[model samples]
Target: MGDDLPPDLARLRVLETWAAHYLTRIRARIAAVERQQAQQQTPAPTAAPPSRPGTGPGRARTPDWGLAEAGIGVPTTEIHRGDCWARGKTLVPVSAERARAELADGTQPCAVCRPDRVLNRLGSS
Candidate 1:
């Protein structure tokens, strides 16, 4: 009223300042979303499916073979077939002969994919 702001007017000014700040933040967020929409990207290319006769999440497919590692300095624990979704950390690709040998040596075939059954049915190599 006379170089001194009234209490109600001061409160209104504080609220207006807060609203302006919030509006600015909301505008910035909206702009970011708009920019993202304007620059939409194509999805990454997918790899071709496995070339096996069978089809499923688990089957003879890409990778073909691999060894499931137990841990650092520990012996490899399990052998898994290609496309076995439940395989743990794969240490290396295993050959058919190696998979057969390992399974015979008690390296424990992956229970989920039943690599032993696949190997047994496939028969040597």
Candidate 2:
């Protein structure tokens, strides 16, 4: 009885050695796969300049002439009369008094807002 270690213990030792070897191989395989994946998936950085100050993600990349026109406070009729003004042809917002004055001066109400000329005045067709 003193010399008898169970057959299961002998088998357990063999399994432990095999499991250790298997785990080592698996770890090596995982490391190799990770390295290969990293090499394959890595993206090269671009050479474009960084965004300017005050700019944010999702900001329009193209020029926005509407904001530019609004910045100068140009009259809508002068900017958009012939479609020559492009995107900035929409009218800048005005106060109620200014709108009344414009209406009194024979300026036609915008088609979109026949009754409420003040709202959505800047949106172009």
Candidate 3:
């Protein structure tokens, strides 16, 4: 094939190959540029509120000390088994189910232990 072509024509074939390779490279570059532009135009996620300091993994929110609206204190002792509040008035070790129900009904936790603090805080208007 080389023998069939003049030196100038052989040089032109090499230039053509170079141009093809350059075009492919340019196409890939353009695709990458398009992807970057698309990403820049898209919106980012909104940041969440920062959490409070000094709270531990098992530690929950502070429960309200106020009496239940029913005028009867939910047996807090059932929740915190060993812990009692203010001269046996409150109890710890609430059952998960009861807690959930109370929470669903907008009940709060014992102010002393605060096991139901999360529900109370959420339920409060």
Candidate 4:
């Protein structure tokens, strides 16, 4: 009589509200900790290498060679340095030698990253 909705349904709704509030609090706490971590960390004094674009806080150390794909049912379009700012539809890891060979075989080089520079720096080493 007092409540318009059924008792069980009302309880479920109450629990759902509580769960959402709890999740919000948990996410806030996690974000606070992440902010603290970012504040505490400092850049290195030595000359360090560049980081990948989306790896987090400019501290990534994962760079190699990769082939950028156009899309499904399409061929790879360009070669990219792992840390290239310009991203393709997809990337497939490959060896430096393979990248060099692919570049030699008419695969387009990424204009932004210029991966070919790394491959041909030594001039046949």
> How do the residues 1-125 of candidate 1 rate in per-residue lDDT, one tens digit apiece?
54454458887677666765565466567767866975796546669854454456675345787788775322348888866655543446789889989989889887668988888888844
Q: Which segments of candidate 3 are over 4 A away from where they belong?
A: 1-7, 43-125
Best by lDDT: 4
Q: Who is ahead in TM-score, 1 or 2?
A: 1
The whole-model lDDT of each prediction reads 0.70, 0.43, 0.48, 0.71
Rank all candidate structures by their TM-score, best first, as comma-separated numbers: 4, 1, 2, 3
Q: Rank the candidates by lDDT, best first.
A: 4, 1, 3, 2
The segments of candidate 2 whose C-alpha lies over 4 angstroms from its true place after superposition are: 1-7, 44-125
Over 1-125, each residue of candidate 4 has an lDDT whose tens digit, in order, gives: 53664468788677666765565466567767877997899967767774554466655444587887765322348888876645343578788888999999999887768988879884477
Clashes of each: 0, 0, 11, 0
Q: Over the full model, what C-alpha lDDT does candidate 2 score relative to the true structure? A: 0.43
- Top candidate on TM-score is 4
lDDT of 2 by residue, 30-84 (tens): 7678779978986668697756532568743332211213222223342122111
lDDT string for model 3 (88-123, tens) is 333333445566566567564444456565444555
Worst 10 residues of 3 by lDDT: 78-87
RMSD of 4: 14.4
Candidate 3 local accuracy as lDDT?
0.48
